[model samples]
Target: MKPQAHPTLILWVLASLLMLAGCASPSLEDYRNRQPVLVPDQFFTGELSARGVVKDFSGEVIRTFDADISASWTDEGVGTLDEVFRFDDGEVQTRTWTLTPVAEGYRAEAGDVVEPGLMQWQGNAIHMNYVLRVPYGDGTLDVRMDDWMYLVTPDTLINETTMSKWGIDVGEIVLVIQKK
Candidate 1:
């Protein structure tokens, strides 16, 4: 007698095939086409700004900073970025970033530092990430940043960020920016 086929095994194989098919990467052109329309004479101007709490090691907001970020990208994925951060108690910082296309996304550089940065359209969100120098012990410390910007409308973005180092929770911030 021939061996009988197992229905459960068949179903599991089918599901695995479907999952692999869904893992294909999106084309770079698809990325550009899907991006929100951000231009000058607008509110956001591809610029970023936010006012939110800056938390401490104790999970408390030890301070606050009002941040302003402006960036522009070229058609070929090469662009310049300007970010300004200010504290409520009188402190100011400015950073410039250079963005260039890499394997699938872009690499972000500030001064002599290099870090991974990504720009992607997931559902309706355009997310970005970078590293910043934070006041650690006797010198500046490197912290990973997960910066998120969501489009509530065609020209409006809602941003919230989380900063962390040593895999420890640091703080959270919220900001609103517009275009035209």
Candidate 2:
């Protein structure tokens, strides 16, 4: 014969487990007042080299690429970053980003972006939110992208992006960039 647990005790244990499971990492707000505040155009200038990988939902690497990037700031308070990417599978792509300062934070515009993206800076990180149109099978898939960049050193930056479609997480991108 086995002893049985009370219903109230079972419910309490389950509730505690659920609460623990729902706990998540710190949000951008948590770093709002931290030190080493990030500045948009200041940290992204000059020539940089990037290596990145794209992973699928299962965390399997699907593609890898390297990019030659050049960032410059205009007198009009606009920053431009030109990136030329060469995929390991022999594909080449170019993307130009125009970043302009706004009242709240900054606005990012790119050819593949659905509209202007909103960027927020905190501590040594910059968070970007946007929707990107990805070409696939003669059509396009609109994916919501939450991009984050962390400055590790004077010339080293790390980036991570989460991609989602229809509110379902699809994949992620991890990249390391070094200034030249």
Candidate 3:
């Protein structure tokens, strides 16, 4: 006969595993010493172009798009990014983002955003979180977006965004933007 493990012991193990998972997430401070620091006010200005793909939860590419962005900044430090996207399926979408400088980062707002997003940057990377409304079956669905951007060169940046619903990842987008 074999001895059985106690129920309390099992619960404790599961709890410890969850805590470790949460602590494993990367923080902005981790990249503080990276090179080619990213400054939104400088990199996001002028004409830019992007090419990217959207992947579903299964990691299958569902759509591809090319976008043209026109970015400008005001004397007061307010920034505007106008984007027009053309998809392979002939769908066209437009979004405009207004970024206001804050003490530590920037407050970002867009037409399809459910609420304003907070953007923070350290070293060469920037991170932002927000809820975006996307067209669904008949109406729309609000999905949380976790966006990360890294400046690799003075004129090039890589962007990655994860879309989640109810704490579950639903899709992702990977793109590269280059100044024109």
Candidate 4:
């Protein structure tokens, strides 16, 4: 005869499993059947404009900006997205992303990105994760960026990016991009 397991122990284990399940992040597959169906090559073409805000960890809006973007694809299918941002504090910045199509999605690279990010889309949503180096107090800090974009219309897209460091949420960016 085998000894029975403790009821309290069984309940604690089940509760721990439930908590872990709740912590799981969303996957691109989860949005596979969503609407609008975003195609990067088609939607990110031509001239575009964006307006957005940056929020700190406490959810306070720290900055805002307007940007202009020019996107084009090469004959070989490589794409370029040139962005120029004008901040409310009278500062200007620029970042250009090179996108190369791959089997799963696109490989996205920028000057400030520590590594190429995998940009994948299903239905109307696109997701990308990358590490970015940003200016800090004296030098710079590398932060993880999780980007999600949704195409609401043929000409409009909404983007949200969460910035984290050391597995802790640090900031967020929310923006809208529209074709011009």
Candidate 5:
């Protein structure tokens, strides 16, 4: 008689496949070359407000915060975004992003950014990949971050950030920013 595959093994294989399929990550190449209607310098100009949450690898919410931001075009295609962040635990911090137009798209520099960040957009989504120096204990952790921004409307933008360390998923940040 021919040997048969065990039922439990078959079920495990199916479950693993389903989980992998459901966990597919977003790719910029999926939307490349499609002209996105996003004008970052224009859409982010004036006053803005944002609310966001930080979640751990298992998707448990770790923290939440809000922010008030001011954005303006500085000179030529260069822009500045000033943000003041207030955390739920009563901690506050500030970050400034200097955005300069580049040949590919834009280059962003900030205090915690290890290197100049690169940005690319297609369709309604903008992708920014960078290494962020996150405060950990007394020092800082250099984490790879993939930040994606989707324009929902003229005044509304939703951003999602995935953070990883050593090629392993660490956490995520989800934010909704709106023009004021």
Candidate 6:
């Protein structure tokens, strides 16, 4: 039998790499100078809930989560992460944080439930990079997530998460929020 060639598979691999490369954000200062999202200081206040399902590479539903989050803004343009509760994996995890705004966006240090991470604002989006402490003999793992917040209205924001776990590219989570 002759050798078979698969151009489609090669094309798909190339396309995936291109998509990943597209996420390389420019410098924070210059990027922010252009068409910024211009979020208000008090944007994170009030009660918010996001519901979504997580899918794998094969487009299979892996897990579902409902995240309840609350925030308070301060005079220093600080977005204080008041609380976060996630219901998923047949378990509920609650996390509390204190956020301080740096040059770009905010840095949240979690007291419980989740590990601490840095969140930066780019235009209409917020990016999250953190280390996940997986429960295993394996050590901690690093993750980079781009969380984009799109405002459907003044009180509604949709959230999307595209992240890599342990330096390996996973899938993403898209959640729509409703304020309470």
lDDT of 3 by residue, 85-155 (tens): 99999999999999999997999999999978999999999999999999999999999999999999999
Cα lDDT computed for each candidate against the true fold: 0.65, 0.87, 0.95, 0.94, 0.88, 0.63
Clashes of 5: 0
Worst 10 residues of 6 by lDDT: 132-141
Candidate 1 steric clashes: 8
lDDT of 3: 0.95
Model 2 sits at a Cα RMSD from the real structure of 5.0
Off by over 4 Å in 1: 1-49, 57-59, 112-114
Order of models, best TM-score first: 3, 4, 2, 5, 6, 1
| TM-score of each predicted structure versus truth | 0.62, 0.83, 0.90, 0.87, 0.82, 0.65
Task: Give me candidate 3's TM-score against the actual structure.
Answer: 0.90
> Per-residue CA lDDT of candidate 2, range 29-133, in tens?
877775566677877798999999999998999999999999999998889999999999999989999988888787999999996798888887888889999
Which of candidates 1 and 3 is the stronger one according to lDDT? 3
lDDT of 5 by residue, 116-167 (tens): 7888777778899899998899998999998999887878889999999976
Task: Kindly report which residue stretches of model 6 are placed more than 4 angstroms away from their true locations once superposed.
Answer: 1-40, 84-89, 111-118, 134-142
* Cα displacement (Å) at residue 37, model 5: 2.1
* CA lDDT, candidate 4, residue 79: 93
On lDDT, the stronger of 4 and 5 is: 4
Query: Clash pairs of candidate 6?
Result: none
Report the poorest 10 consecutive residues by lDDT, candidate 3: 17-26
Clashing pairs in 3: none
Residue 143 in model 2: shift from native, Å? 0.9
Candidate 2: the clashing residue pairs are none
Better of 3 and 4 by TM-score: 3
